[model samples]
Target chain A: MQASLFVSCIVDQFFPEVGESTVRVLRRLGVDVDFPPGQTCCGQPAFNSGFWNEAKPLARRLLRQLEGKEHVVVPSGSCASMLRVFYAELLRDEPAALHAAKELAPRVYELSEFIVDVLKVTDASEIGGRPRREPEKVTYHEGCHLRRELGAVTQARALIGSAPGAELVEMEQPDVCCGFGGLFSVKYPDISGAMLADKIDDIRRTGAGAVAACDSSCLMQIGGGLRAQGLPIRTVHLAQLLDEAATPG
Target chain B: MEATTKQFTQSAAKTLSDARIQDSLRGLYGGFSKARERAAEATPGWEEMRTRAQAVKSHTIANLDYYLEQVEARVTESGGNVFFAQDGEAASRYILDLAERESVKRVIKGKSMLSEEMDLNRLLAGAGVEVTETDLGEYLIQLAGDTPYHIIAPAIHMSKNRAAELLHRGVGAEGREWDTAELTAEARRQLRDKFIEADMGITGANFVVAETGTLVLVTNEGNGRMCTSMPRIHVAVMGMEKVAPTLEDMSMFLRLLTRSATGQRLSAYVTTVDGPRGPGDEDGPEQFHLVVVDNGRSRILADPHMREALNCIRCGACLNACPVYRKVGGHAYGWVYSGPIGAIVTPMLTNLPDSRDLPYASSLCGACREACPVRIDIPRMLLHLRRELAEGRNKNAPVAEAALMKVWRLSVSNSGTLAAANLIGRALRWPLLLLGRLLPPFSRWARYRELPRPVSPFRSRWKDIFRT
Candidate 1:
């Protein structure tokens, strides 16, 4: 099965490995991972900043890149959901794009969603981890975009459980936002910090060796908070974890 | 009068950051938030009810013109005068004209955000009429010479001490600092005289049911009843979207409104007045008038992404759940309505440039989404408004934020450049930490907290670490 990659702007620029891990995981699952180089942002920064006009052009560009695709998989649920749920809302006036968005939407899937739904991979071919390392307790942080927007919480948990030798521990309010809402962290750091503090505290209480999430933006935040507090917990993106689990054992 | 959102937010942030102000706001927000959580948990099928409430609102707003016309006809048939105001100026003019016709020297008012949007107090006061806010929270803030910081609790930003001081100044009765009860009594005494002598009374409606031509008001204080009934002339100002399709819908909303707003089974009073006095109604106003103000709602409705904002019940559960609101408080929103709902409503209701900063004031936490009984997709709307602001549709964002975002768009749009930038960003983390601590923009973020350094760049460190 062929699938086009929608490397979220954040992963495209700042964390290419997330994109790499995404590609590796898809390819390992017997899916032909195509990097549609023309892909850009999901236009959330513009949309979140209230620049629908500025975002509209970008949305058109993104829609143009992946039109008529059988499957378009995005690493970040929020960005993917932006195209799925809000593109039509944003481009409501432009009926052609709106129609295109609607056609493209049902096919667009978050990573876990594609893994479980489209790729239908029950087991991932992991490369590196064969002999299980010391079993580590890890907790999952459900990014609001994934849980609320994509409604992929159950799918994410299923993917996590599918990983080899990884114990899935639930933290409190896993769906709570880590408060790193793109520019929001920079704009309202005090409140953002307070919210992150609570999130890191929740992870610490779980005694997790790592905090896992799909979106790199949230990983940056939860990881940042864990580091700031000098907490021992490591932060891992779900793609990287799934990549670890997909190691050719 | 032409307060841009930036100017409003700055002033509001100033108020929020004040040590004394936060002290008061902390108590206000914390109590309401706790109460709301308990209430939400206690109510079975609360979440379902919220969704249903939102459905009703969405259905109502989709057919707003029809529902409003139904309300207008009903109100007219009930012997009440209905005036449709195109904007704030028109609404104020019509209300002011009523005051003039009544020779109103004073007007007793209930807590009405619509009036605040109209700046009715200032307008009426400027016209040489005394407009006394009778709700305790509103009265306290009025005496403090400020607008409400919260929709339900207007004086949510005021401490007991500040309330005492405002009461002392307004009442001119000196005594040892008194408790809340004593202070409330003083306000009651001061406002009671105005209620009796006022030539006119003005209110903001919670829901105007088309079936009955009835304006529903939910207030914890008995003050709204007095303001509605005591005067010879009563005028109710409402946003055009405040109309419900039917009384049955009003029943569902009233149940949802109070529960979501103050965590009350119902407010102390839920007054539904239909026009003026009936045959046996001796104390009711002789003349009742309903002024429906469109302001910018027509524009909002024309644009489908924004029209859902018109469905707001003004319960303020969204505000209470908003983390940004918890930090900055309502005053920081720089508009009459503050919080998630306010961010969406303010820009649409007022001139665009004036409320640009409002949409950015949130963390988009979605807590507000959870709290909203009518289930306004506030985070979605915030993003919508943010898009509007970024496209230079707003006049308020600083040149620097705009420029920075432009550069951000450029760099993030490309893979190779962004990857290189990320490497440099990873390398400069140490220096950026120092710069963030010392510089202007970064200093703002670093001021209250410590910056967390990046672990090695995700790409550079990926292979060996992941072992995949």
Candidate 2:
């Protein structure tokens, strides 16, 4: 089955490697993937900041781009949530936009969700007939939008647990927000820093070599914090880890 | 007591840096939240109970006028007086006038958040009526000349040593090394005399039963019972939305309230005061008064978007679950109500412009919604308030923000403009990184975390793969 990849704006601009890994993982799993070139952002920043008027056009633009794709996959949970959960609410006044959003929502899926639910692949052996090389230790950070909004809690965890040689060390409150709430970190730096401090401390206690999350936004925040502290821990997107496992080098 | 909500940012900064407050907050975070989770797990059909409570509150709020009139009629028929006050100042004045008319010299109070909302103690004391707080937590904070740091646990921000010091200074205790038992006994000993000597008693109602004209109060301390029973004149103040149509509805709320607030099956005391002492009653107040204060709640009730906030039972569950409140503590909210409930209610009930920052304080984590007993959509309401601020409906909207959002909308709407911006961003990554350190706007982001450098845009990398 052919699917359209919704590479989020953050991954498009800041972390293209995550986008590349997402494409490789989807292609290797025997699903035809296409990038809808007209796609940009899901209008979360404007919508979340209470600028519904400004966000509507961006939502409409996305609906226009992804218009007839049977399956749409997003690597970022926040952007996927914007399309699947918020678009209809954001365009309630306009009938056509609302209808398009409603129609497109069921087709939208986060990356791990698409892998586990659609492709029925969980571990490395299930993909491309290869055993995986796993790091010494890894933990998963559940993004807020993925876990709470889309209810994608167990899919990513299941994949992480089944990675060949990696030991899954569960951090304390893995579902707690990573404090990279888009504009929140920029607006309230001190409070954002305080929350990230706690999150980093929790991650350190797990003694994991790397942390994995579904969304690139969370990885960037977690990676930035780890790098700033001079910690050697690595941050990997779930798609990147799955790709690493599926195509062992 | 004063409205410092306008200074939320400054106070939050101060609160974050204060080590003692953070320590007390850490202790509170574990104690209250875990107990609540355990209580919810142990209770069968807790979710069903919450739904029923929400329905009851919705029905009552929708028919508030009918139930309020029913309440007034029943109380009047039962030989009790009812007063309606439009705002906090009016409510305080009405109580002060009543106190002066009745020649009340001393007054004792139970733990009443409504009284706090009205700044009643300061008003009453300024009017020369000596008001004594009877609840243990309330009494300690009162002695320390501080407001409540929490709804259920008012002095949760204070340490045991701090409490001992406050008591030693206020009540003339012997020394500072007082244990919990010693402090409790001392507070009880000191408050016992005031409870008896006070000419009037004042308390807040958890729910007002309209059908039976009964006022229900749930408190962990027995002082709620004493505040209603010991004095000659008894007055219970409540928000206009606190009425329940029947005792059956009251029971459902009672089940949800205690479990949500303190994770108890029931509080230590559930006092039901119907009216003054009847002809054959042995011990109770002679005169009973019920003051229903609007104080901007009616305005909130009138607005369909915000009417859900009135369904709040003041359980403080949302506060314990809120991550922002966990970090900044209650005092940073800078109002009577703190945490999620405070964030919504303070601005809506008071000046929205002054308290605009309260709604933006949250990360919209949805934890408050999961924890609310009546299912109040606090984040949605916060967003609504943010929209109001953004649209310049409230005078506090920053013009530069609106313009920036407009520019962002224009930039992101077209794929070409977005791609061009990304191309520029990728090309200038190194120079921009250097400039980011010197600029204040970018420096804020770089203060605690490294900024991610822009990579080749996805459109450039994906052209080869999709070309085939």
Query: Tens digit of lDDT per residue, candidate 2, span B403-442?
Result: 8788777666777988777778778888989888777556
> What is the lDDT for A189 in model 2?
76
Docking class of 2: medium
* Candidate 2 chain B weakest ten by summed lDDT: B169-178
In model 2, what is the error at residue B295, expressed in angstroms?
Answer: 0.4
* lDDT of candidate 1 over A1-249, digit per residue (tens): 988888876776557778878877777777876767666678887677765666787888888889988899888888888989889888898999999999999999989889887766645333334634346676888878777667776777876765776788998657667778867778766666666776787788887898888888888777767766777888888888887765655
The deviation in Å at residue B374 for candidate 2 is 1.7
lDDT of 1 by residue, B1-468 (tens): 334466754665576457776565545445776677777789888888878888988988888888888888888887799999998899999988888887889899998988888888889889999888899998887888887888888887776777877877745444555688887787888887888898888989999998778999988878898888999988999988898878888988988888788788788999988888868877789899999998777998898778888888888887777656766777667677888887887787765666766777776767787777877788887776766666644545667887877776665554565566567777898888899888765676565345555444434433344334
Cα lDDT of candidate 1 equals: 0.78
lDDT of 2 by residue, A1-249 (tens): 789999988898888888998998888888899999988888888777777777888888889999999999999888888899888778888999999999999999999899899888776557663655645699899898898778888999988888766678999768777788876777777887777887898899999999999998888888999999999999999888877777856
Model 2 spans with C-alpha error above 4 angstroms? A120-125, B170-177
DockQ of each: 0.28, 0.67
